[model samples]
Target chain A: MIHWPVPEPEIPAGTHPALAAVARAAVAAFRDARGRFDRTQLAEKVDMGADGTPTTRLDQLVDTAVAETVDAHRVNLISEEIGVIDNGSAVTLVVDPVDGTSNAVAGVPFSAFAGVVAVDGEAVESLTTWLDTGRSWHAKAGETLPYRTTGRRELDGAAVSLLRPHPKSEDAWLRVSRRAGRVRVLSSSCLEAALVAEGSLDAFADPGSDTHRIMDIAAAAVLLPAAGGALIDAYGRPVEIDPDLSRRWSGIAAATPDLAEELAEEINRPSS
Target chain B: MIHWPVPEPEIPAGTHPALAAVARAAVAAFRDARGRFDRTQLAEKVDMGADGTPTTRLDQLVDTAVAETVDAHRVNLISEEIGVIDNGSAVTLVVDPVDGTSNAVAGVPFSAFAGVVAVDGEAVESLTTWLDTGRSWHAKAGETLPYRTTGRRELDGAAVSLLRPHPKSEDAWLRVSRRAGRVRVLSSSCLEAALVAEGSLDAFADPGSDTHRIMDIAAAAVLLPAAGGALIDAYGRPVEIDPDLSRRWSGIAAATPDLAEELAEEINRPSS
Candidate 1:
């Protein structure tokens, strides 16, 4: 037998107590439910989510675990499966109980549990736990010792992750694929964005499509900017995470503001 | 500290002892060198490999470890780095010391140490060790219990992994991407093929370019077939792995022969 260190949850000081509690609850719930998750039950569709995606049995199990945790706290909750729960609290907790659902179901080992706390539509604190590996990335908005992004600026030798292209955006996807030195499709937006923030990946590009929801980008929005990177919409504008589940944005999470702008132009440029 | 079961090295009883020893050496060599590999040395191109790719410093370190092990055996060897060595033996061991070199250097955790022992131009035994996790996949020809591919036939819902598309085949890559339910660029052909063998992924398609050499496909050629899947050339022809580093093939590894043929047609179909 080989001994591996169990990760101790460390909630940074100055984070909202409620937010820290939610994050802890999320990590514990996922760890408990993951062991009991039956692979045979993965394909069973439990319900249609507010986001129009089918909620599998695995999604329901994890969603309920996280929802119950957030419900205990007096805060508004916005999630993929259960559109929104108005708790009549000042802060809103945005959560994707299980990001990369397909990967989880298929045992790809690249999914995550993600959550973010927002105050009056501005993200203040966030946490992302890699479900397969117990490592977590957390950030508070105004912390001095923030995480940092790599100083890589060019695409020629840069490693970038892109969302799988929709049929309409094939040309744009191809152009980006050709230009970037290396391209990957990890299928987890928040985790990939966290990787960009930590300098493992140079950037993550989402083609201008209605693919990403608030729950998907909330944690990343806080983590990236805090890490010296920026996650912006296709027009190089700041992305706002409202309580609405229907709002979708196309954007890039890059190591630098300059790289984000450069990628936005490259992706949005017309093909000659 | 939590106790995790260490994977016991299990070489099938009927397998050739020499091939099994090589597999063990490859795994141990990778695990030892991986910990000491520095990221700063990743970009130092020490030499141009016989396979035409620039051999990075990390590659040389692991390659040397693997080569020394193979040299002790009375068998010919073919590899990406030092070309071929003839030992006046009937067996030819094909090895890719570090598949997915970029991913290893960048901390992507999806690279592998892949090897295959061939007898008279036919892959007789194969091994692929995932360097990130200590899990391994091995197969011997004529074994009753081979690995299996998923039963997915249609492309509409298939999860396919492609080698990053080159500029000339951007249109073909787009066609595959649009038709498949999910498309991933994992960069490691051997690991991706292992995923296909174990049914984690439905298929792994290598675009018809000179991107893949014998060392890259040797293990997949053995394991995929044993698992009730077919790894064929883009023209739906059987791939032949010889002691040549210069031969390249465009291929698709599907869960079934029918699916392989379908993908070949889809990729080779005229781009209108």
Candidate 2:
């Protein structure tokens, strides 16, 4: 069993009530699940998710709690496992209940609770909580973040985080890894994007894999720009709020617009 | 500054008193350093280490604290920064004061304090503490660890952690990554080794990158064997406690001897 306890996220005062509730629910549910189940049980595939992928037991447990919290708050939720819950309300919560389910279930302590508040199909604010340490990053559209990025305009000599290499994107992954001064595969996209926002990392990308769903990049869309960074797709597609969970993109988040653009161009270069 | 607090390590009972003191000293020094220095200041290169590499201020501060603790306990010391502290005693503490200094300085929270108690040039016990969370693992040689390994015999479907891809070792890195069921580059060797001991990961390897010094893999030398696992050098060299800091090894720690051998063989394969 993972004997480590999950701490409460350091959410700021003015966060949306619904977002705060969902974050709390996720933290509590995750803590309870870790306390009860061992690694194998927590990671066992329980059912299919809304994203057309297998869901781990830990994901299901946390999603159940998040669902109940969203219901009680009378808000709609577009999430990884639960798919869509439209209550005919203007306010919607886009969430990745467990951003790194594998890490969480394996007792690696690098998963996160990421959510964005969208109104009229437009994201207005976001929050990401590192479940292991309760460190959080919160931001709203059009407003400057309390923290800032490194303002790096190029990928050379920059510290970057990336997804695990897929066969399809192996060459693209290697290209980025070769150019960057330091490379990491933390396996938690949300937490990685938060690091980029806080100036800890210069950038984070999916290379050319196109593996990210809306829920995976939604909070980052709202967080990055406000933190003096830019968010785009590796293939020049827009990262927007969508109820459809099947659509995927290779999200590229970086410290500056130039860096994001340069990453997209580099990742799209022909594989050697 | 990294706004997170470093908690006290939960060192198990019956650990060597000198080892525990060094752990405490390292923790306190790390907390103090993080509290005072910003990321840039903390990560700044302070001096060249005894290992013939640049040392960060964070490493230097923590190493100084550990050195003092070793002196107070009247034991010799072999570490990254301060090199060999020959008190002329039979007891020596082999330590990596900050195993993941880059991660720690950048607020990634994946760094560790790893140490081993060596008597007459043989490691007898080990302790590894996650400096961010204070969670620790302690084990003695020739005694079974209460928490055992996964006992995985093959790398076909094993969960593996690796160091980041280096230029000369990229092909070898991909070979291991492609064959594994799950791949991670957490960039913290000591913490990754601890994960293997706790069964959270099946194995961790350097993938033909001869980047590991004695302090980097010393604790795992004692921990893995006691946890029903094996530790081997990727090039078939013996991993022993040596005072020569310039020497390097590609360390492979696995859940079983068979897995360790398979990893070494795979890593040594010719590049594709």
Q: Point to the candidate with the largest DockQ.
A: 2
Give the per-residue lDDT of model 1 (tens digit) for B1-272.
00111233445566566666666776565555445654556646899988877898778777776677667877877889978888888888888888898887776667787888888667898888776655678887766344467867777778899988887677778788788888888889998988888877889988666477878888888888888887888855557776567788876778887788888888889989
Off by over 4 Å in 1: A1-40, A73-75, A88-91, A119-121, A144-147, B1-37, B144-147
The residue-by-residue lDDT of candidate 2 on A120-187, one tens digit each, is 98999999999998988999999997789889998888899999999999999998998998898988
Per-residue lDDT of candidate 1, residues A199-266 (tens digit): 77899988766588888888888888888888887755557776666778776889888888888888
Tell me the deviation in Å of residue A91 in model 1.
4.4
**How far out, in Å, is residue A92 in model 1?**
3.3
Fnat, 2 decimals, each candidate: 0.71, 0.71
Model 2 chain B worst lDDT window (10 residues): B1-10
- Tell me the deviation in Å of residue A47 in model 1: 1.0
By DockQ thresholds, what CAPRI class is model 2?
A: medium
DockQ of model 1 vs. true complex: 0.60
- Model 1 chain B scores worst on lDDT over the 10 consecutive residues at B1-10
What shift in Å separates residue B84 of candidate 2 from its native position after superposition?
0.6
